[model samples]
Target: MFGPWWKLGVDTTLLAFEAQAVIGLRLAKLAAGGSAAQVEAQRMVSEKVLAAGEAAMQIATGASTGAVVAGYRRKVLANHRRLSRAPKGAAKP
Candidate 1:
């Protein structure tokens, strides 16, 4: 439950840090290169890395949201079950 949520956050943060490191390395390579082709390749690699990071973040966010929703749904269902088990004074219209 809450454990999974915390794990997800930690996992996502680690992924993001890795992605940033990759992008930084690519940038450094691009800066150290003398040829235009090398620079262009590095730029492409950086773009791909950033795109992957964005996708990963999106997936993590979606998972977190789904977990929260599911937890809320479970709580609501439990409350409903409790209410149903109580004695009612009047019948529903």
Candidate 2:
């Protein structure tokens, strides 16, 4: 009866968990401490904000929820890839 509703909650929780892990890793990288790292962190924030704004605009223009979500999902996966990779010649975490 409540399967769809419960599934919605479960899916949302999983997405949050995944995003949190990526965020934590990103913070750990930033914590290594350097001007370049800080700058890169700021840039990442700006990129996310821009993407969110774009998504919002798509919704305002009557785009389907799935389309907006798919776009954001792509961005999140891309960020995860970028954040999880070790920079060239950098020490392992």
On lDDT, the leading prediction is 2
Candidate 1 per-residue lDDT, tens place, 12-56, comes to 565556545545654664676668438557656675576557556
Residue-wise lDDT of candidate 2 within 1-93, one digit each (tens)? 997667656656666777787788778878887985798689888988999899999999999665666676677778889887877798985
Clash pairs detected, candidate 1: none
Report the error of model 1 at residue 23, Å: 1.4
TM-score of each: 0.40, 0.73
Find the 10 residues in a row with the least total lDDT in model 2. 4-13
Q: TM-score winner among the candidates?
A: 2
* Native-to-model Cα distance after best TM-score fit, residue 86 in candidate 2, in Å: 1.8
